[model samples]
Target: MLKHTDIWRAIDRLAAQHGFSASGLARRAGLDPTTFNKSKRTTSDGKLRWPSTESISKVLDATGASLSEFVTLVGDGTGTNPLQRVPVIGYAQAGSAGYFDDAGFPAGSGWDELLFPSLGDPHAYALEISGDSMEPVYRDGDTIIVSPAAQIRRNDRVVVRTRGGEVMAKQLIRETATKIELLSINHAHPDRSIPLSDVAWMARIIWASQ
Candidate 1:
């Protein structure tokens, strides 16, 4: 007897509790910003649309909310979660001077601040996607959250910088003792294999605003 309205209401309440709008919540969960939009909740013919279980699972994981807590939200939509304000920069700017420290942590000036859901990574920063090089998966104007301190694993999406100041976002295919292989998100782009000695830094991408 789960009503569509009730489910959507719960999502709205959950976003508000975490200091986000519906779109922001969707982004934090690595989903399209319109996933929970009111305009997208029903078809033009007026057929109701329910939130997908996969989307729900991602949101719960991103917010660190338990299934029991979400069940309570579905019924009563009550609770409050914390928010964090993180440094923000453009992807292109990330390759420039004075933007980061030697360890790839946010540093120097020219950084804006954005209110985001707390992910518990003190070094987390936001990077705004700029071009079609990462299109389809991450379109232009999308914002991604990067954590320099997070552990990097195979197949994880990441942002990397080279000693020559080239910055790119790609999936980590593999990492050997001497080299790192990366798969580009855009099929048109070729994959990369860079020597470990030439990489200035590499950080995992934890979330993205589509």
Candidate 2:
């Protein structure tokens, strides 16, 4: 039996595959930007709403995708969809309450998405650098992909959030069972050392788009 979720999720997957958000894809299809938004998935009375065939056809036309391809997407998005999807959030949002689980996976709803060619950890995510704090190597707007499941090593670029509410990116200087030393990417910023117990979580940065 074909579930409605399978079809819509396929559409979402299709939009993501093309590097477009659900809203962006809808706009490209000459439909309302919210055409595929999750908020519209259910009705005011909690009834499930499906995308109109007209809207679907429009999207197919806009992307030059044939019905056969659409069917493929439907099957692909169907729980069996074969792609590594990453959740994305801004640095500020990353600091916002309840955005990430203890292991650093996205825990909240409505996070933006990233489709990587491959990802080892399903929990891996990309955080957009917000300030020039990581200048020279990483600039504002650079997106760093972090994998919590990846092993953290000495001298690797990492994102660390402390229990006291400090979140920053620094090169790993050194680490021990009791403490961690970090080197600021910008020389202007001084190196920091903190007790490991004070750190909420730390993840190595695997990739960054400069």
Candidate 3:
């Protein structure tokens, strides 16, 4: 269960990590300066007040932080972890051979490294978006973090590799024993339904540096 204090503390730590005070974070998120003030955390009657989901969303977007990263902060509330160096590759290049292992985990050469907060997934890697196929949500040149270890569910944004060597990012629509359905991020692109046998591997996209 998520504790009220933990969530508030996470917000404070997130602000501090980005070199901002609580009020500054609120302002950066386009909220009133007092939105995250300590005094506002509780009512005059001492009733606990939780942050609104919209406020949290705005802060995350403003900070370029992932939901997973905020959840980690909720647990640790410590921004002490050192930046991690993770493998990175171009989205288009990911379709080429020798880049990923059979399970879709990054492998072989031609991968560069990037320093980012540890996402706690050993198989996590970054992909630089190349074309407008995923536009609006993930523009060209955006960096997206993918984790093969993360659990995939309906509607989760994911990176998928096919046995035929096609790699693409899309939202998972449905999956079953025989097929996987994907909804394109850009409406201009057509949604896809691939046989399970054609899918070499699929991984959930955990974060993106927009």
Candidate 2 achieves a global lDDT of 0.80
Over the stretch 1-210, how does candidate 1's per-residue lDDT look in tens digits?
Answer: 236776688788789889999999999999999999999899899999878756877898889886446655654334553456689898888999878889999897557877654567878999999999998778888788899988999999999999889999999999999999999999899999999999999999976654
- Clash count, candidate 1: 0
lDDT of 3: 0.85
- Alpha carbon deviation, residue 75, candidate 3 (Å): 9.7
lDDT of 2 by residue, 1-210 (tens): 234565688679779878899999999999999989998888999888767656777888888776546655755423563445678789998887788777767897777776653455778888999888898778888788888888888899899998866789999989988999999999988899999999999998876643
> How high a TM-score does candidate 3 get?
0.71
Instruction: Give a tens-digit lDDT track for model 3, residues 73-174.
Output: 765435454455679888888999988999888887656877655567777899999989998888888788898988999999999999999999999999
Leading candidate by TM-score: 3
Question: What TM-score does model 2 achieve against the real structure?
Answer: 0.61
Pick the winner on lDDT between candidates 1 and 2. Answer: 1
Inter-residue clash pairs, candidate 3? none
Provide TM-scores for the models: 0.66, 0.61, 0.71
**Per-residue lDDT of 176 in model 2:** 89
Q: What residue runs in model 3 are displaced by over 4 Å at the alpha carbon?
A: 1-20, 28-83
lDDT of each: 0.84, 0.80, 0.85
What's the C-alpha lDDT at position 68 in model 2?
46
